[model samples]
Target: MIDLSSARLSRRGFLILGTVSASALILPPFLTAEATAANRYQPFSSRLSLTINGRQRQLDVDTRTTLLDTLRENLGLTGTKKGCDHGQCGACTVIVDDQRINSCLTLAVMHEGASITTIEGLGTPDALHPLQAAFIKHDGYQCGYCTPGQICSAVAVMKEIKAGVPSHASSSLIDAPTFEPREIRERISGNICRCGAYPNIIDAITEVAEASA
Candidate 1:
């Protein structure tokens, strides 16, 4: 008894009805499949080989797994922190093939034959990297989650500066990248310190840089 001609459906109403109709049309076969096939589908896996902390490693990982998960779950290098897993926070930063990267944004299978360095590789109880010692000396550890990534990024940042890679500070300052505090700040901006230890962190990096220079 509904009057089709009298039904003045607005654009929003039309879209809603269309969506319902499309879902009704498409969802039956998808939902009716065996529960194992539909719900328990396994992601494809690939064999990956990479060097970690100066040790060779081989693992079979699900294609969907990120390098961060591979390090934490499979190879068990847990120093790399995971925050804002979409690559925004830079907490899961690690050095890959001599360059720093957000491990959460990259799949493990993509880095076959690559070299990775985590915070565990940096130092030990007796021996410490200069940056690590500087971090400790300058009181740079606050809550300690971001320190690993911060240190890793700092190590790579200094190397990048030494290699003449321009900092975000300015084009005119490219030649003297390591000498300025602003250049170091701009370079390590991607690594965030939620505990607000930035002043001491900068102090540590500056001391390390000065000592090395």
Candidate 2:
């Protein structure tokens, strides 16, 4: 039994004001502990070198960063669009070691020593790549957001077909598929043109295929 008349806080008032009041006034260190832990999880500080766009580049980036994120956020190479973070859209496609892959699906750390070519490396104002010129001539794109991926995919498709990679339209079991519109469309079907430019896109692909052959 204690005296309550001269107490700083009344018994009833203290009971009404629970531990929440005290917690509101004072926070524990754990509030920011997770952020501190994340900061501590730094990537290897060693410099990484890779050839990009016919030029060698050295960069230091977080190990967890994806190639698409590194290109767009770190290097300011925004031509590789991010239509979908997942690999379904092919908007983030890039040529890695002469192969087209979804940049968004690959970690930058994985391509530390690989050669990478984005749409920026493909064409320039003076001489656009054949595929790029064809796309322009055929009006293959409307919004043009997916143009980079489309071109990269088209380039890789030609190389693959030349290498005898069979498509769904391949007629013979032993012989390589002919460079036909159906073959090109089937091979590049992974790349989705949201603008519904399939006809013009196919036209562009056919033009390049004919020129290549």
Candidate 3:
């Protein structure tokens, strides 16, 4: 290669080279069409269609959003509490396809086309579910924060017993789980009541179970 010092250089060629170098330094690589296409940004979001509380609903949510947030923030169904988002506490519990689950543990997009029911769907002020009424009679709504999850879980517990699903407290795995205090307590152990009102909660669930029976 000829040395630039020894080579004859036209004024226009040097000016053009200097201008191209400056443009490369000033402009971002992504500003180019090829760069933009190669580095396109894709949002982490998904559309979900769900039958919530007997109503058909559809919404778009971040793929990372939990079902608890979708219910409370997106759908305005705030009755499903968001305590201990790590899924240890059952405060974020809800019924999906007649089965109870911790809403905080699942992603909203994962339940597309699934039916869900929060505490608000159970009953209104005028018409209380048997469990809700029983809770009131038994004073089980101690602090009231964990009441939603407790009631939801209790509802599922009754269903599990009727469905003949065995639990750890059951006397035999082959037989249906008994609808007794020990079985009820075991089924609902995931729910925590900070108010330390376990006895009242158990009594309320027992009352509902007996009445339904």
Best by lDDT: 3
Candidate 1, 105: how far from true, in Å? Answer: 0.7
In candidate 2, what are the lDDT values of residues 48-94, reduced to their tens digit? 78888888889998788889998999789899999888999899999
Could you arrange the candidates by lDDT from highest to lowest? 3, 1, 2
What is the overall TM-score of model 2 with all chains considered together? 0.80
| lDDT-best of 2 and 3 | 3
Which segments of model 2 are wrong by more than 4 Å?
A: 1-40, 43-46, 168-175
TM-score on alpha carbons, each prediction: 0.82, 0.80, 0.78
Better of 1 and 3 by lDDT: 3
Error of 3 at 69 (Å): 0.4
Q: Which residue runs of candidate 3 sit more than 4 Å off their true CA positions? A: 1-42, 170-175
Per-residue lDDT, model 1, residue 165, is 80
RMSD values, in order shown: 6.8, 5.4, 6.8
Task: Give the residue spans of candidate 1 off by over 4 A.
Answer: 1-40, 171-175
10 residues in a row with least lDDT, candidate 3: 168-177
Please give me the total number of clashing residue pairs in predicted model 3: 0
Checking candidate 1 for backbone clashes, the offending pairs are none
Could you give candidate 3's per-residue lDDT for residues 84-109 as a string of tens digits? 99989899989999899999999999
